[model samples]
Target chain A: MKIAIKLAYRNLLGAGLRTWLNVVVLSFTFVVIIWMKGIMVGWDYQAKTDTSNWQIGGGQYWHQQYDPFDPFTFSESHAQIPETFNENIANGDLEPSLIVAGNIYPQGRMQSIAIIGINPKQNVLLLPTQKLDTFINAIPAIIGLSTAKNLKLKKGDFTTIRWRDSKGMFDASEICIVDLFSCNVPAVEAGKIYIPLAVLQKMTGMENEATILTFRKNKMDQQKVDDWVLKTNEDLTKSIDEMIKTKTFGQSVFYGILLLLSMLAIYDTQVLSIFRRQKEIGTYIALGYTRTQVIGLFTVEGAMYSILAALVSAVYGIPFLMWQAKVGWTLPVDASEFGMAMAQTLYPVYSALLVISTVLFVVLITTVVSYWPSRKIGKMNPTEALRGKIQ
Target chain B: MENHSIIQIQNLTKIFPMGKSDFTALNNVTLAFQQGEFAGLIGPSGSGKTTLLNIIGSLDTPTKGTVEILGHSIGNLSAKQAANLRKEKLGFIFQSYNLLAVHTVYENVEFPLLLLKLNATLRKKMILEALEWVGLTDKVDSKPPQLSGGECQRVAIARAMVKKPVMVLADEPTANLDAANSHHILQTMLKLNQELKTTFLFATHDEKVINYLKRRIYLIDGKIDKDILVDH
Candidate 1:
């Protein structure tokens, strides 16, 4: 087996031009796949983590509907806070909570902002290596880095905020800036502020109002988490059937076309490479190798190409994604609300699990693409092969 | 054919279907060579000499009839089984020498032994002995591209014989060489045949190759036209 593999390697290496060309294309594809994967993975991690931090925990969460007309009135009837919520929090058995309210003003000049309220002490239990105390002090306010920068609100400065209450009432007040924070997920990090739950209740004039109660588990099990999400989605659809019209079929169509184009590029690379090596493949068969061996060899060759490409792509791609996570990709100022919402997006956080999964997926795609052409070797007749003939 | 016959072909036929017509590459051919015999298969371009050689080498399956090599029927062998037989009992030397360009002369010669699953020390010994027989020991480290046409052919021969196969199938082995190189290659092959008693079967249209063979079979249009034995 080793000898056969070594010969295959040498043969591929011998045809330097074809091998390098294949490697270049494969590497390019690998980089593209890895980059897209890393970005996607980064986005996904950022989304999940931010969702957990701001509102959604891995499995279940809650979102509130704020009245746009009256911004300061408290209406307990419109809010959904289970009676056991306070008991769960006091017992320290409840999932984390991410209380978010839009149109928050952290300065005298009003701007569209996000306000997140959390139990500072309990927040550390959900996130690793994070000290929620850094964002709290005697004055106590945790604001997004972008929001603080834009508002010119330093940690020791005083800031005022205004938002609509549950009863469609508007209210305004001053709070002390405590600390600044940022997340890789752009949507949550910018234009947002974090406050203690007690302080948020005082500011909003609601004694027990929360935008969402996020659950944080000790372990991250994907299947269980997804199941919980599915259950929640099912509940949401059952309760709010009219909201189903908001589902974006156009987005699915767009992504489907994009994915098809990417796959086509990969397919073309494999087809061109296999076509060029038809003669050499014939040569291997002539040398007394079985048709199975021929297919195995070519498939292995394609795999090798993919593995090499993956390595190079990984080397560069992982770091780039990390950098994006560390320093978010910024968008221009003066953008629309939607544009601003997406402008300074950071890469999803990096995970070893995600990277390994990406590589395996790319390898599988490469093997499948190469196999289509390599199967032709199984039909080759050795007599014709030995005569330097092509089928 | 006797039990000791190294190769036996009984009523072998190969018909290639071309569109609506059928082309017979090898038609009802029956032939055999004994152990240690030097045989020649002479034919024109499409006379099925290579097809017969391929069957004898266990590289291809016959369309009809049975081929037995070293007491085993070719039809009974699996693909891997046939590969093993070729690695153990049959050697091949193509017209182009087919020396893998990246490999040195020694490595090229060691190619066949590597397939035999031999240990490193035994493989080295066999390769060295084969290279020495072909007078390529001095150029063991030279790659195929670094060697002349004659040297490349010698390396191919060394690769073939390194496994000490029972028989060798040479398809126009000297066709790529000039007259002098061709003569030298034949002399080397003849010397190896006499010393080791390894059977040799040549398939060629070249008269230069036929003159060097002790026994020759003339094939025309996939049929044997003449079988001649020369005075050794």
Candidate 2:
């Protein structure tokens, strides 16, 4: 095997321009696959991190009747805060929030929104709840940038908001939009507004009642209560995981096409090398190489293209990948409409495993493609081959 | 089979399968070679000289009869064994000077020793010595395409002789060279044959090559037509 490698190396280098051309094309495969895969991985990592910080906060306990997808459930989702989590809530390890279906009329235009009541001083979530502390004539409130933009409302704007109490009695009140926050997580930033948990508790006449509990990662293991359902961090981020998984798989198809084209170049070169170097093949046999060894030599020769590509990729890919990691790929403003946790700029993250596995995959496939053509050498008649016969 | 011979063949017949009928490349041929003998399979095209050489070189197996080279039967050796036989004891020279075009002249000559798995120091020593024999020590870095026909053939000779094989087989080794270049190549082989005492076998109709042979075994229509001893 060592001798085969040496000879194959010499043979490939001897081919000069043809060898380098194939190497360059294949290097592109390495860089593109790794770059694209790294982006998906980065997006997955970024999405989860953003979601954790901005909204979910490691885990959640939702009211049994509450469903974020079903706003109608908001009418009955709340119950008294369970006594079991009271200590955690006091220590700021867990944050309890109340949700009420509401509509906001800004400049006589109405927008259906979720009026979420959050603690004015909570660190579990990255929301600017401190902004909810500002005292104003109307109830102080904080809305996300997307919500503010849609309603054409900004900070210091008084907006009329209306909702029902627990008894189904209708009520209306004014809200001072104290601030608008920006975040990568569209779900947290879209169609949602925040107010002081105490203020909403008083206004809704649902005192000491809550709809969901958000806790710091690993701070609370308490998962079950009579009317609450536990959701771990993984559970909250399952959609992002699935989306990235699906995108990665789709990217693999593109990778397959890229690899196939590169492998086709290698396969073509192997076939042509075998075809054109008939006399050389026969010479190898004459010099005491077994047919199997010749086949192995060709396979090694073809697979060496990937090794060369890996080296070539390192020449240019490392700098490009490092630059990309430092400065991320920015998404268009329209990407916010994805309705999931997508950042404005996504930085790719490449692991050793991703690079190594991708290289091995390409080398293995190249070897197979190379061996496919050289197998003909096994059944060749060395005498005719010596004479450069077509067969 | 002769006990004193390194290569012994008896009634060797090789038949190839044409589309509908068999083509007999070698028909009921018998021959032998003692060590250090300068010999040639003297014949024209279609005379089966190359077919006989291929069989003796263990590149092909006989349809019938036995060919024992250095105590190994060509007819019975497996592909690996045949390869070992060729790699270990036999050297072949082709008509068109089939030097590896991509390799430097020195690398071309070093190919066989590499196959032998010799140490680099020893391989380099042997390669230098072989190149010296062909007087190509100066052209070590020049690839085959960069060299002339005569230089190419000399590199091929060095490659063949580098292993110090028990026997060297030449099939029209001088066929591609001009008369002057042909003489130079044949003379190099002659010097190596005498100095190394390696048995030399040639399958050629080239008169220049035939003139240098110590023994000429003529073949025609897949049979030995004449076997003559040249008093050189």
Candidate 3:
């Protein structure tokens, strides 16, 4: 095997430009695959981190009647603050949010929105709830940038909000938009408003009541708390995992195409080598190599392309990937528009496992492709091969 | 097998499938080559000289009878065994001087020794000596394409003789060369044969090659027409 490798290296190097061309193409494959995969992995990491920071803080406990997916459930998804969380809430480790279905009239356009009432002093979420701490305001509210844009609302704008109390009595009040903050998570941004928890409880005649409670720490010992259901960080991030899995499957098609292009080059080279180097094959046999050994030599020769390509990719790809990780790759379109947790600029994350697996994948593929064509050597008549005759 | 004979052939036949019919290349031929004999299978084109050489070189097997080289029967040997036999004891030179084109003269000559798994120090020493024998010590770094036809053939000769094989098969080794290059290569082989006591076999109709042979076996229509021993 060592001798085969040595000869294969010499032969490939001596082939000059032809060998380098294949190596360059294969190297391109190596870099592109790693870079693309890195971007997806980075996107996954960033999206989950941002979601945890801006939206689902370590975990959530939702009212049993609450279903974020079902807006109708918002009317009944409310309960008095549980006594078990009172201590944690006092310590600022747990935050309760009262959610109610509401409509905002901004610039004479009515938009249905989810009015979330959070503690203004809460630091568990990245949302700018501190802006709701203002006094002398008719119901101070904070809306995400997307919500503000959709309703043509801005900071210090006055808007009328209408909602139902616990007795099913409709009431309307003029609210002041104190801030329009930016958030990467679209679910937290689109058609959502934040106001002080005391103000919403007082207005709804349900003081000390909350629809959901978010914790700062990930662990929740109680799986069920009275009428509340625990939603762990894993459960909150399950959608992103599913999204990445689907995206990865789609990306695999591109990976296959890229690998196919590179493998085709190797297969073509192997076929041409077999056709053109029949004399060399015969010479190998004449010099004491079995037909199988010659095939192995050819396979090794082909696999060496991947090794060379890896080295070549390291030369340029490492710097490029590092730069990308530092500066990030900004998408041309708005990523938040996808209606999921996404940043406009995503930094690629490359792991050691990813790089090693990619290298092994390409090398294995190249060897198989090379061996596929080199199998013709086994059928060659060495005497005719020694004459340089095509078979 | 005769103790003095390096090759023993008894009623050997080789046939190839030509379309739907079988075309016989060698027919009921019997011959033997003694150790250290510089001999040639002198014949015209299609006279089975190369066919016989191919069989003796273990590149092909006989369809009938047996051909034994250095105690191993060609027809009975497995592919690996035949390869081992060639690797350890046999060397072959081609009509087109089939030197690896991408390799330098030194690398081409060092090829067989590499197969033998010799250490680098001994391989280099033997490679240099073989190159010296072929008067190609100066062209060690020149690739086959960079060298002249005569230089390439000399490299092929060096490659064949580098391991000091028990037998060296030359199939029209001078066919691609001019008279000057042909004689130079043959003289080198003659000197190696006399000095190393290595058996040399040739398959050629070229008068230059036949003239240098101490024993000549003439073939016609796939059978030996004459076997003559000449005192040189």
TM-scores for candidates 1 onward, in order? 0.71, 0.97, 0.98
Better of 1 and 3 by DockQ: 3
Evaluate model 1 with DockQ and give the value: 0.33
Q: Which ranges of candidate 3 are over 4 A from the true structure?
A: A218-223
Q: How well does model 2 score by local distance difference test?
A: 0.91
Query: lDDT per residue, candidate 2, B1-232, as tens digits?
Result: 3678998889999999999999998999988899999999988898899999999999988999889999998878999999999999999888888998888998898899989999999999999999999998999999999999999989988999999999999988888899999999988989999999999999999898889988999999999999999998
Question: What DockQ does each candidate score versus the true complex, computed on alpha carbons?
Answer: 0.33, 0.89, 0.92
Candidate 3: lDDT of A123? 94
lDDT of each: 0.66, 0.91, 0.92
Docking class of predicted structure 1? acceptable
Which regions in candidate 1 have their CA more than 4 angstroms from the true location? Answer: A40-283, A314-328, A332-336, A339-348, B25-28, B63-65
- Model 3 TM-score is 0.98
Locate the minimum summed-lDDT window of 10 residues in model 3 chain A: A217-226
- Candidate 2: TM-score of chain A is 0.97
Cα deviation of B4, candidate 3, in Å: 1.6
lDDT of 1 at A334: 33
Off by over 4 Å in 2: none
TM-score of 2: 0.97
